[model samples]
Target: MSTTTAPAAGTSTTGGPFSWTDDGAAVTVTLDGVQVLTYTYAANDPQEESPRPYFHPVRTRTGDLVSAYRPHDHVWHKGIAWSLPHLGPDNFWGGPSYRRGQDYRWLPNNGAMRHRELGQATDDDGTFRFAHSLQWVTQQGSLVVEEERSFQVVPGTDSSYTLVFDTAMTNVSGEPIHIGSPTTEGRENAGYGGLFWRGPRSFAGGSIIGPGGATGEELRGQRAPWLSFVGQHDETCRFSTLVMVDDPGSEHPEPEWFARSEPFACMGPAPFFSQEVLFEAGTTLHYRYGVVIADGQSDAQRSEALALAARELLAATQGRNGQ
Candidate 1:
């Protein structure tokens, strides 16, 4: 008995009948995707926008990308490159300056850079598919944080799609890769960038970003574990999906993040790494993440989604390397 399925309805995110594997552990879609990415990793300080200025979703049921993130400045996500690691006074919002030097006070936002490079995508398995890209961000000649992102998708019976992310970072320059090895990293006072998730208020913790339990000064919010960010209408959880991203080689390895953190929101340090991987010619690093988008947050749904996300991520990777 072969384990596979075809989306029931409304599951054609990229147009072509995105196949499935193991229920709904993942998903695959190829619409007008922009493929989000960045150069800098951490938004150490409050910048013009989010540390992750880019967004890429695998299966939105439409052959076209989502245009832009539904929320926020309509900053055009789906298929656009992006970055955020350091910076100075934000110029995008109000052109980065106080009308009056005395009233507003133009405080220095420090050094930060935003850059991105094109990524690769592929898919061959008749069951699933995937897409991969990269991001580059750094300060003005300060430090750089780059990300290699891969988006995978698994289709299910009820128009469900599981999304997975494989994340990796490399030191383009001949230097070491920082790590809070066995823990987070930073200037201590800088409160090392934490993996956080934003959820409802009643969910216990407010909107804060930091390690679980251990709160940081620049608190944002976090989500509960074993769950993914899914909307709710009445008693039903809409848009079922499970997304998991962990870098085994990362500082702490299996990063401690909440289950409800879908679409993903977090950061890490790369420049200060004592484990810097010197690049004689082209120094690069890598990380792998996983996501499972499914139907309603259910025990059966999540499991199925994970399998799908993993399969799609692996399947769609054929398009990389100009394959």
Candidate 2:
């Protein structure tokens, strides 16, 4: 299923150094004629999944697939998405909700983030950027939050690329909204929420890298400004590294990470890992992150260098926006 629309201003159809293809339902970014990533705003997922915008088919500079969608263990685990498992009494992360006493159960509180409008979109001079306005509504069709999301993909070295994601959400539910994760609901160290990523099955048993030369699942729930996962592809046995960096200016700076490489390779900065953040009725919350996707396994030194480069890029972007 797809939706079609007239191209918005600044939308490019001709190929150049970098280009964009907006097919209404989703948008794709390409570099030198190769796709880097695709963001799906109008998903055709089941309501039970609390459908929301996500980035899939994310690729390294060499075009190696690094993302997974609807994996068996978690059908709702899309490639890369800004998902929140707990929002007051609603569930926006999809699948079963983890109640403190009742364990996991399906509830009628699934909320969906529906794309409402497109904002500025540009593809020029080695840069590809886009923005979207969305409405977060509950299963019963009631507004909970108004959100604005933007993305910028930047070229790094020949073997790596960087993507910056920024989001601002305003509470419009008419009351305070509590945002949290399963860990806040009694599931220990299960703080799997916020900007999440699901890696391909071939990435299983990958290496997790963090600050201070940290390597392993022990970094889970640990505070860090950046984290990385190094995985080897199945067919060619080539390695790739993914690095995620949390903006120091975000609502939750240096967030605790929810990382794992045993059962599957996945990692993300969890803002509400162990606590709930209260969003007042008229308040807004913001978050920004930079991701570096490279074509080889990143050792401690390389991962740190790539993370620092991404941080500099994000800082420059924030400065340009006067944020």
Candidate 3:
């Protein structure tokens, strides 16, 4: 028993107020301390959103699972550990988040997404001027994915937090969704979200993708696609984001990079069109991605954090030329 329909078509939360939870199925949105967007419209789940939801910067120690590779306590190297909204299960080894946790699909870590907040981790300014639009339709309607992720805390900018990702993915499922880029073709296919490293061997050298680190504009494939690798942990830095589709005239071919010298390093498969992606039920997709968490990674501070996340996703598309 689950149903919710309201905030969409222009948004206006003003980052003013926030809070939600639906134990029955899905829907968890908490944008105060920073982020937490869990919305599963059923039809198979796991692609979660936690911590930021349940309530405030709550994470006293959600089952603490760290060790396989250190980095200030596993910063969710994979997808949501156990929200079950997007399915993440692949513990093939248990270390490095299950060494790829079977590409993750298994959900629920009990504790019902454990959460609880009161204070500490706020920016105020309302935190981010709210703009809300929510929709989750299923049942033969196929699928509709509309999500609004807003952020704010730029009074002077210190702890820093100014994000904005308004997404809309309606396929209804007839064919033709063709939405790639789960690190470019689900990186190893399991959950559709990844990042793994085991430590030592010189902390597994770094650099994941290319273009000073990460950047994609009007991307299709080949014609000099990409596959990256950059390593270093002592100083804080890591990279590995491949790009592949299928091969042959390669709309999505494989190997633009590969180096797995038996746990030695270097691996970029860059799979694009998972298996020839296509959609037609109603065909809908709006892209947005900017995972910027910087402080080190040279080359002039990783090209100044990819030019400040490409100038805020180029003012959110007003200035096209996106990637």
Global Cα RMSD, each model: 11.5, 2.7, 19.8
Residue-pair clashes per candidate: 78, 0, 61
lDDT score, candidate 3: 0.29
Better candidate number, 2 or 3, judged by lDDT:
2
lDDT of 1: 0.32
Report the lDDT tens digits of candidate 1 across residue range 196-294.
222221222211222232333232222212223333322332333333334322333333332222343322222212221233324544444444433
The TM-score between candidate 2 and the true structure equals 0.94
lDDT of each: 0.32, 0.86, 0.29
Query: Taking the tens digit of each residue's C-alpha lDDT, what string does model 3 give over 1-323?
Result: 22343232211245454444434333444434333433332212222222211111111011111112222333232221211122112121122332222543423321112111111122243432222333333322323333333222221122222233223335443444443333332444322221222223432434344443443221223222333223343333332121211112222333222223223332323222233234355755343322222222335344444435434443443322111
TM-scores, in order shown? 0.45, 0.94, 0.22
lDDT tens digits by residue: candidate 2, 153-213: 8889848888888898999889998888999999999988899999999999999999879
TM match of model 1 to true structure: 0.45
Best by TM-score: 2
Cα distance off (Å), candidate 1, residue 310? 4.3
Q: Which stretches of candidate 2 lie over 4 Å from their true place?
A: 1-16, 319-323
